[model samples]
Target: MKRIDVTRNWQGSRLDRFVRAHIPGTPFGVIQILLRKGLIYLNGERASGAARVKGGDVVSIDIAESDEASPPPATKPKRGPGKRAVKLPAAGAAAAARKKLRPAAVIGRDIRVLHEDDDVLVLDKPAGVVVQPGNRAERGSLLDSLEEYRRRSARTRPRGGAAAADAAPETIEEPPFPYTPVHRLDRDTSGTLVVAKTRPAARALARAFARRAVHKIYLAVVEGVPAEEE
Candidate 1:
């Protein structure tokens, strides 16, 4: 059996995602099956994959280290720095192949990145770019460029387990390119948009949008200008 302690970084995150984080390279379907079989528990009770976990909670998984289905590569976090590094699965040739197939509008495109942090990424999306993939769209999307940007960033940063132990133990490292668009602008509209780097941040931003707490302003370019009073 393996155990994990929930921290504030994981608060409000889906239980299934949390589990997947610990066990790298595990498929989502496998995680769901474990949850359904009651092999995974939260605070000693069987919990659904969608259950939200908060700080100070304990999660237990009833899988053997030596089992054929499970591997021993899972790193056990120690109480101090300089622990074993967590290995993120390498980006394979498939990713490169996909990038090659993307349109020029996406590949090597200059995205006007406004701001970025551990929680969110802000971008000034260009007018001709789509926010996400669609059946009818022919060109590339803002998200495709975002993924490429993330890949570049990942190359510069140290993997989570090593960095966390050496610098800030409390930091919960996000997966590479896990960013998701919280909201979107029309393809023809050019404006700033925010993308969530983590699930908790995504949920918070979603709530803010749902409650209309976020304010928006639009601008337009016209051929002629009218009187200020009119």
Candidate 2:
């Protein structure tokens, strides 16, 4: 638990951004999770990640020191010296990779489907599920599940309904899926996630987010009361 007072010069910044500036070595994802859980406060009230802070505001951040721990090591077997290298079939290799990459198939696991349509899908993701693949080997993520869903849906759609004469030939692509997430949510913070199903939709959604047209709100619990409001 730590208490920090915001100075006049630190006003007009997002709460997460402000905290990142002051705390060195703190991951932004961790801060986001804290903000979502109400561990961060502004003027004695729970603060959202998007909450605006003015100068001279007293912000209290209640972070549990134990929750921040290094990730476990990889579980793959180590290669031994002098082992004959055998080339696997390219197609087989690709399939294996996909299987390994298939994000956790844990349906109904800490996620709530908020809205679904042809162009987009919105979900309320719970804490601890990685939104996307990372450098590590952790499987099962929101993107992976969405990619699977997309494949199933594409299979069911009627084909040859409207083909563009000059359209480029379609090709098989890898999954992390074709859909683009308009924005990201922290692994430990549960919140709404918007995913675009098509390239055009993806671009439009991304632009909307970039322009701040999308509205987001986070709820958190704080440690103490504030002396004054901003």
Which candidate has the top score in TM-score? 2
- lDDT per residue (tens digit) for residues 1-230 in model 1: 89999999998888999999998867565687688888899999999998999999999998862133442353444535653332221223223433554442222355555555577666667787788778646446777677776787779887678766789656775555467888989988887677787665777678657644465669989888898644
lDDT of 2 by residue, 198-222 (tens): 6656766775565444545679877
Q: List the residue pairs that clash in candidate 2.
A: 37-220, 38-220, 38-221, 103-140, 104-140
* Model 1 alpha-carbon drift over 4 Å, by segment: 1-108, 136-139, 160-177, 225-230
Error of 1 at 44 (Å): 60
Q: How good is model 2 by TM-score?
A: 0.45
Counted clashes in each candidate structure: 0, 5
How far is 168's C-alpha from truth in model 1 (Å)? Answer: 14
Alpha carbon lDDT at 178, candidate 2: 78
What lDDT is reached at residue 98 by model 2?
Answer: 34
